[model samples]
Target: MKNEINIIIITPELSKEGGGGIAIYTQILAKELSLDFEVERVVTLKERAVVNRVRVLFLSIVKVFYLLNRKKRKIAHIHTAHDSSFFRKSIFVRLCKIFKTPVILHLHSPSFALSFKKKSEKQQENIRKVFKLADKVIVLSKREKEWYLDNIEKRPPLVVYNGMNDLISSSDKVSERRNTVLFLGQLGHRKGTYDLIKAFKKVLENYSDAKLTLAGDGEVDECQKLVKSLQMDNSVEFLGWIGLEKKRELLNSSKIFVLPSHQEAFPLTILEAMSTRLPIISTFVGGIPEAIENNISGLLINAGDIEALSRNILKLLNNTLLCDKIGEFARERYLTHFKLTQTTENIKKIYTELL
Candidate 1:
């Protein structure tokens, strides 16, 4: 029997074509919650072009207003990022308030605190007002929750770590994987793509047969130029904007996963790597330290420290026993703390409380 409760999830596009972690999280939440609750997903920001986006956003607001006009009690779960995304979702939050419907603002921006500080004081006040209107606010990490409490709002936001289903299967074995280091995200300075390329040049000095695969879109030509300048054309391969199957294949085939991002809020890529039991090498920023205990589950270094990044890559490459141990621990951590079911249950509890 289906539950009587209704959940309307408003987010950006859910398709893999142009979606990121926010879209993936929204998809997972909708899928898992649909089994019990009456879940509906509304796509707001799908177009890349600005004029098109404005048109779509207006239509979405109209549609949501219609949906909320009904007499039934409903909840609005709005997923948003920084800058334009925040403003876009704020409209829906206001609509919820007009209808007296409960609204849950789920923030997904990795550098929200930094970006919020950079905004003008008036804009910052507007953001704070939006948060105050929401019935509840959900952050991706404890660090983010504290930032929101101190800066955005006086009320404490709930910290629900982004979670996903395990990608590795019983047949997959780490010993059978290749000597490949994989990076999955936008190929730009923010994700430290150039730094990873520079560090990989150092890794090639020790392991000539090792490979580096970069999978994602953004600044591809620039990254390729850097790779070529370092004389690493043969060692580095760029796969632009891959889908789920290709991501799974790369995770399964690769020996290590590296995402030396300058900023992050519990990246889904790290969780993806952890679930596959590939020892991770990432920078200590945002909520990374919470998930990855240094030298235990995975390795962590300060952002932009190319020497340390290279050293950690070599450390995992040289010691097979240590790599397996860290990978095993990472999998255990994922199962215990970051499972999709756990996130769904926590979210359900919040919904129950609000209803």
Candidate 2:
């Protein structure tokens, strides 16, 4: 065996709690990759790739020269960049070319452009330029790849569905009497936090005991205000930013997992809920459909459709057998496709080929 592939994982952030799914992916993937590769993670402290508030270009240039000066470095991978300054991109691209190293551009965002809003001309041009520089573009889902394929004239992307580490140890511990519907993920417009509240309000007509406990954080005050406005303050529990222990705790007690996201690239949260045998009710967006087979593993409703979201939630709540059946199916699907080991093997293949 070739002893180790010296690989560097460069990203803007690496905080476990603050960085969301990307950080989780980096942490887990790096640990797994360490088996075959000597992985070095270099994260910028701020949004700008800075070293003590200095530009990343300066330090990246220093790092690249150091690597090139030393021998046996196999790959220099850059993870997730958005709307970077021209100097950073030029310096990075030029350095990679000079060193003759493969640069893997891993894209975490569902959209190709930096801002989800209407893109400025400069932003559009810069995005295209960045795409051109990458040797390989690793997209998290097929839906995300579609945007780049249609818009950018660059090397096409590879779709690698986000993997889930088998952290749900208490799979047998089922909630016998579940009264709560759990929403675990970013609480924002794109995530459909508003729609979930509206649907939960509608659900209260018949299943008055049904309570919504939100896990994770984003626009927390706004989401809480909406719940209060709907007089769901009594019905909803805003458990903001639960840790791993608390996340598992919430998942165990909850009847159903709901994510009414308008845009998603693949959610690890859904897989986690599934592993714990909670039936899912999600919007038919992104890789969610790739995983959820619309009432098979879970129910998939149209994004922002409050009525359909409520209907699906109510269906699972009313039929205990249906909930159990769907939960079983969801767990089986996760085992088959989304397991950490399986995903790691697939990623290893990609790295091997690239190297």
Candidate 3:
């Protein structure tokens, strides 16, 4: 076998507690990157038990020193987001620069652009400096790339859509799923759970059998209260952070998949929904539009528009032919453009080109 290309990845969270989008993305990405590159990953976020800030700082300095001291040539792949995350990863970025190591800042935050605006001019300059130091900057979608250009004067950032495995084949394109509209993400305002609830209220007027299953963690208590207040307890179900098998089971069983999130950076769950051949109803925010063609592969609506959301939900639920057509087209789109293999290959190419 060819001796692999050496690369070191530093991420804030590696364990399950830290298992947000970045954790899932890192696990799959490192695995794929390892096929052609020798990857050394560093998880900065400590376990449940932690000491004071001084101790954390000392430990971080020591870890960076150790990683930079390695004899082999490797790109420092820094995964960063907003606020404290930027500060922490900035340390690694500066260290890589000090050691003359090539750096690639893989930005994966939807709130990153907004956060940049919150910072002072000096702080924003420092953030831009961090971007400039990188040998290459990777953003999630075309929208994100534009945002970066607008904020930071640097080389055009690269766009890489997050990818997942496709579940349904062309032959298995038909969806026999129940009249359930599934929302698979964290439960909160940013995810549009409240709007989904309101929209489902409208949906109930037409098809009383329609069910909305939200399968993730976040603000669940508040969500429970909202459901009770709205008197939708029976129709809305919160599975509370399900495992992969349970998620797949729900995706397979559900007829419609809806993610009304007001913010995103090319969500992997939407791709997961597309893979399962579920007709999608998501907001037009972020890079979701890049993956979904409005009324073609999936229906896109304005964020917080409960009426429009419910209208699409009702449309798909009533028309079996339209639902199946969209679902089949979505799966076909996934196979054509958004497979995990394609993502891995594109990433591999980027690495080779950079070298």
lDDT of 2 by residue, 107-132 (tens): 77644353633677776676677668
User: Which structure among the candidates has the greatest TM-score?
Assistant: 1
Please tell me which model should have the higher TM-score, number 1 or number 2.
1
Question: Across residues 223-294, which tens digit of lDDT does each residue of candidate 3 receive?
Answer: 889889988889998888877777778877888999998888889998988998889999898899999999
lDDT, ranked from best to worst: 1, 3, 2
- Weakest 10 consecutive residues, lDDT, candidate 1? 168-177
**Taking the tens digit of each residue's C-alpha lDDT, what string does model 1 give over 1-355?**
8787778899998334848888888988899999998887888988788887988898899889888987767899999999989989999999999999999999998878888989999999999999999999999888888888889878899999888888885545566679999999988998999999999999999999999999998899999999999999999999999988899889988999999999888899999899999999998899999989888999999999999999999988898888889999999999999999999999999998898
Q: C-alpha displacement of 319 in model 1, angstroms?
A: 0.5
The TM-scores, one per candidate, come to 0.97, 0.88, 0.93
| Cα-based lDDT at residue 267, candidate 2 | 80
> In every candidate, how many clashes are there?
0, 0, 0
How many residue pairs in model 1 have overlapping backbones? 0
C-alpha RMSD (angstroms) for model 2: 3.1
The clash number for model 2 is: 0
Give the CA lDDT, 0 to 100, for residue 151 in model 2.
75
Residue 205 of candidate 1: its Cα lDDT?
Answer: 100
